[model samples]
Target: MEKHPRVKLHFTLTRSSWLNVIERWTGQPERNTLYHGCFTSVKDLRETIKIFIDSHNTHSAKPFRWSQAADAILASVDPARTSMILNS
Candidate 1:
């Protein structure tokens, strides 16, 4: 960390499900295509995930955006911190 001063650290809650959408989304691919499956090479794995991603995007993917910055978003739910949400 000292050697790489430009790199900063940010921590997240271990038990927050609402903020773990990436984990949830990634699990779908693993369970749908990778689980109990065999891949002979890296190319096969990439192609499989690519196909799954393309199909999912075409049929099921929804648009997403971050309405707030990281600090504002995290502060909203953090008990130790206060944001506009807490005051309201």
Candidate 2:
């Protein structure tokens, strides 16, 4: 770190990956079907959830795209830079 002072570090808590997946997957169904929904019995709740999932699955889900274009990042660096962004 001392040798390359311009670099920065970010830290993530252990097991954070599951938390991200759980949040993304549950948000839509929870918002539309489960949140504040009234069901008369256990069977009613399960049936509603099953229907919601089946309906949701009919629509195609898009793949996550990772476009790691570095142009914008490099542009943000100061013009008075000395060292190359990547060391040889």
Candidate 3:
């Protein structure tokens, strides 16, 4: 890392929050199009996924909105709130 002075590194303590958002978004197609559907071969599955991605990108893709304030997000995951959720 020291060899590349211009490069910066970012580390996450847990799964990337952005990755969770992406997974949630991609999961829709998995549930709606892939699940319980039969594919004759690897190519078929690839094509299906491609078609779904293309359709989504062309029709339903939208810029993600971050409406929640950071404080609100922090509050929701505070230790006290986590304990309450776990105990319940």
Candidate 4:
């Protein structure tokens, strides 16, 4: 890590809900394009991704909806522990 002074590292907990959400979102493209598909070159892969993104944006793009209410989300956290972590 010292070799790249400009790089920053972020650590997330195992089985984090936020990480799961992102994985689930990206899994669509991986399953649809990359899983059983093969590309001749990097350019081909780029074009495939571009087409997938464009089609997804045009037809199925929608804002993410939070399943939990703000208060419920906050309630799941321990306020004292959160404060301690923040202070650390």
Candidate 5:
């Protein structure tokens, strides 16, 4: 890590690849959307990626929303740690 002092390193927790939520979200598009489409040119590929990412961001950008279950989960905290937040 010292060899690349300027670059940031982020280590995912061992034994839980699925715990990486971004990986889970990316995997959904890779399997169901990206891999199925054939792009004719770089411009086409870029446009496709932009459209998909924009669609994802529209729904996934917020932390708490009335219609999304993921937002509800994000809004929740462990009950055991709730008291710590109050005390702090």
Candidate 6:
């Protein structure tokens, strides 16, 4: 905290490695796509990775089931508040 006071820390709860779903998915893509593709130079490899990531993100499903984090937060806040918040 002292070393990087400007940087915010995000800590996920234990037993919830699934919270890092993006990284897990990325590793598989690397092994299946990038790793198998031949690259003659570092620039070639970098460009290939950039293209793959852009294409992957374009075709991938939304990160969370909910459209927005705010919506999820409001929905989970209180069952009573759900009607008011969502309708508001």
* Candidate 4, residue 70: how far the Cα is off, in Å: 13
Per-residue lDDT over 1-88 for candidate 5, one digit per residue giving the tens place of the 0 to 100 score: 6467596544433455446766887787778677989989999988888888898789776663456577665566344346555534
Best by TM-score: 1
> Candidate 5: which stretches are off by over 4 Å?
1-19, 64-88
After TM-score superposition, the amount by which residue 15's alpha carbon in candidate 4 deviates from its true location, in angstroms, is 10
Question: Could you estimate the TM-score for every candidate?
Answer: 0.56, 0.45, 0.51, 0.51, 0.45, 0.47
What is candidate 3's local distance difference test score?
0.80
Q: For candidate 3, lDDT tens digit of each residue in 13-87?
A: 454687877889889878989998899999999999999999988998997786899898797668655666664
- In the range 1-87, model 2's lDDT, one tens digit per residue, is 846778765433444675887688778778888998998999999998888878877774556664555786456443423333342
Please list all clashing residue pairs in model 4, or write none if there are none.
Answer: none
Distance from true location, Cα of 45 in model 4, Å: 0.4
lDDT of 3 at 84: 60
lDDT of each: 0.80, 0.69, 0.80, 0.78, 0.68, 0.69
Model 5, backbone clash pairs (residues 3+ apart or across chains), number: 0
Q: By TM-score, is 3 or 6 better?
A: 3
Worst ten-residue run, lDDT, model 5? Answer: 9-18
Task: Identify the superior model by lDDT, candidate 1 or candidate 2.
Answer: 1
User: What TM-score would candidate 1 get against the native?
Assistant: 0.56
Q: Kindly provide the TM-score of model 2 when superposed on the true structure, using C-alpha atoms.
A: 0.45
The regions of model 1 sitting more than 4 angstroms off are: 1-18, 65-88
